[model samples]
Target: MEELFKEYEDKIPAILLEELKSSIDKKTTKTQLKKMLEALYEEYLESMVEPGESVGIISAESIGEPSTQMTLNTFHFAGVAEMNVTMGLPRIIEILDARKNIKTPMMEVYLKEPYNKGKDIRKVAELIKETKMSDIIQEVSINILEATITVKLDRQKMKDLEVRDSSVKRAVEKQLKSGQVKIEGDEVLIKVKSKDDSLNDLYKLKEKMKSIYLKGVKGITQVLPVKRKDEFVIITAGSNLKDTFKLEFVDTERTTSNDIMEVYENLGIEAARAAIINEVYRVIESQGLNVDIRHIMLIADTMTASGSVKGITRYGVVSDKSSVLARASFETPIKHLINASLVGETDPLNSVIENVMLNQPIPVGTGLPGLITKVKK
Candidate 1:
């Protein structure tokens, strides 16, 4: 086989050759092998992009057309009304814009070994689900006359949340360091340390008790254990990728966050790029749109090419464009033009936008060819 394709060895890619070699079995014939190679070669040629093609425009149009038909709403999770996933046009927009803080930031956390096999999933969910002081408290009553605040703890709720009286007392004392917190049966008494503490101060302390961190992972507002295929997974309302990965039972490789910047910062630019493409594709596919993955890949590559996740907007990827005309063409023409002029920038008319701005044929496809004159010899 090597001798048969010796002439075309340099032409064929090494990866394709390796794939062909790995796919062949002992019973495979020389004729069958030759035919398969030919078919693969044809496929490789057919998939190649044409020189000077306006791929950017094509990609934009491919995705943009289907996006208009997408629903501008989130899908509610069955049995969990609070867990609504941001899908459709809004989700696509959020991903493309690379918003630092997403509206409904979430995480799909995969577990390892026995945990993934559905062992103690509810307990794991309870452990990670952020428990605030307000969640366990039945009510708060302030006694202005006594200059003290009384917080009634829900013992049943605390038991369900897997929290103890000692833990609650410790958390309250540590959180309200300015005040003295004493656990009296199921009630927590908060008294101001200052002898001259006013009624307003007592009221303020009572209000502060509502948001104190009691237990569980920070930023993980809610966690729901879900069964997928043969494994159990945790879907969270809020995301904290960095800390979530540190959990012993978590499958770090499979865990992902919806926030692009969070992924970029914690996972790296490459992961962010993949996340952008997958996220956009997921949104599009969820809406039953058939936009090609290549289009999403182009958008993802553009967003993460600068070693950082950037939005497709004027302030993000557009602002980083080397071509002044390209930047000006996106949005805010005056701002781009003034900034370019102030910096003594020159438009070489090498790109599509700059050439088009001057009422010239854009340097793409047939327009890319320069006129050549022949001299008689």
Candidate 2:
């Protein structure tokens, strides 16, 4: 196997070779291995584009055609409404647009070792879901006469969550920087820290204190523990990739967020690229569309090739195009033209759009090759 691999290492792709080696057994003969290598190499060659092929347009059309048949509804419950995911055309558009704030930001948190086997499923789920001060509080009252806010904490809920009152006090004190928090029996008393504070400020503080981050992962509104195949997984409604990774039980390698920007920030551009491809493919697959994966990969490559995830819009990938005409053709022709003119830019007519604008042969396919002849001297 080693010798066979060495014989075709330069000819075949490393990824293809690796897959072939892993699938084949010791009983496989050398001749069979050589034949397999040749077949893969041939297929690879056939899969490659022709010189100066207009691949970008083809990929666009391929993706665009199937996208029209996609479902209009954005959310797909997949039998669990709590885990409702954005799907179909809206999701594809959301990803391709590279919108910073997606419709539904979610994360799939995989656990490590014992926890993954459903040892502490509910406990793990509770630990991930964001617990606001209001959620764990039984009642909140504002005293007009004394100008104090009284919060009665639900001891049962706190006990079930294994959250101590001291921890709650600390969390409240941390958030309510200008207020004095005191524990009176089972109720938490909040008094103005400054004598100059007004009733409006007190009301504002009361509203703000309700949202204080008391426990669990912040931004995670809901968490559902699911037994996927055998391993238990936690699906969240909100994405906080950075904080989620800090948890000791989380499997950072397998745990991933659906927000592409979040992935890019927490992980890197490569991971973001993979996320984009996976996310787009997932939407298409869910919609029962048959668009080619290569088209999706091509778009992903374009989006991440610049070392950042750029949208397909004018402000993103289009703005960075080398050809002024290509940029103009995408969107805001007047603006692009004005900017190019202001900069005294020149179009070399190397790409498709520029040549088409000049009414010349678009430099792709047969037009890519130019004639060079020597005349009689």
Candidate 3:
């Protein structure tokens, strides 16, 4: 039994090391790494693998965190001046495992010295807030207007412009009684009840004034236009519109160049951009396509960088160096075998035998096959 355990332990590390190497070569994003690990864990369970059978074999949850915080300190180690890392989720796991301090799947680690505490957490929170806000504003429109006041009319509270002989109250009453002015809410409206040709001229002037104000507002809201081969493209310039594009699905069909331009005219450039990105993301998600959040993030970044939305790629935000073989190797029963070998002090071959005796999961691409041994006389 001891010899068998030793054999299993030796093989466990070898398998795990190979998996780590593959992960590095592929430059797998953090999300991909997590998915690969989860698939392997499922295989381990089916094979009924046990702990202490492998080296460097950890639970799936050990390396999985929805968010990660890293803290670094600049210092000199061995005459090398550089940044020394003190705290991070990954580092914490490594330290705890090295010391065999915990066996739980999820845990947290805190640092004491050489670390600027709470800084990274604050930064991450701020960034998330900014991202969420940008996402929300991507669909809205902004407009600014300036207008000139015309036909000003005023009635004095005093009955006489010469106030030497009149009381203020009496003068105010006289103004209200007269048809010289009208008050609507806080505004004073002067009635221009005249059929003179000059009144028509005044009306025309008011219309012109309003038109000019609208044009000025439109100019401020104008955004950079995209040059398409056969059509003109336009997008808003605002973080909110960019973020709205992050949604899984919203509305894409209505997000054409003309529609975007219309938004620019009605809402302004910032609101138009937000609307377009939101619509684009909505369309992509509605098609049942699987895309990483990082891909969307990259698109937003590219749009901002070039001041136009175009040229997004899979490899832009995330890599595609996936390996089926490497993924399968990590899923094997090798970890359990290695742990058992190390604990029982045996060899790889013996470890396999003992694992089989325990009816534990064995390493296979999808799952370990059931085997039957026959005795001959």
Work out the TM-score per prediction.
Answer: 0.88, 0.90, 0.18
Give the count of colliding residue pairs in each prediction. 0, 0, 44
What would the C-alpha RMSD of candidate 2 be, to one decimal place? 2.9
Per-candidate local distance difference test: 0.86, 0.89, 0.33
Q: Count steric clashes of candidate 2.
A: 0
**Colliding residue pairs in candidate 1:** none
Candidate 3, 294-364: lDDT as tens digits: 44343344433434322223222111113222222333446544644567733342233334555765443
Query: lDDT score of model 1?
Result: 0.86
Between prediction 2 and prediction 3, the one with superior TM-score is 2
When 1 and 3 are scored with lDDT, the better candidate is: 1
lDDT of 2 by residue, 114-171 (tens): 8999987999899998888888789999876677899998889988888888988898
The runs of at least 3 residues in candidate 2 whose Cα sits more than 4 Å from the true structure, single-residue gaps closed, are 1-5, 14-47, 76-81, 373-377
Q: Please give the RMSD of candidate 1 to the true structure.
A: 3.3
Reference-based lDDT, residue 196, model 2: 63
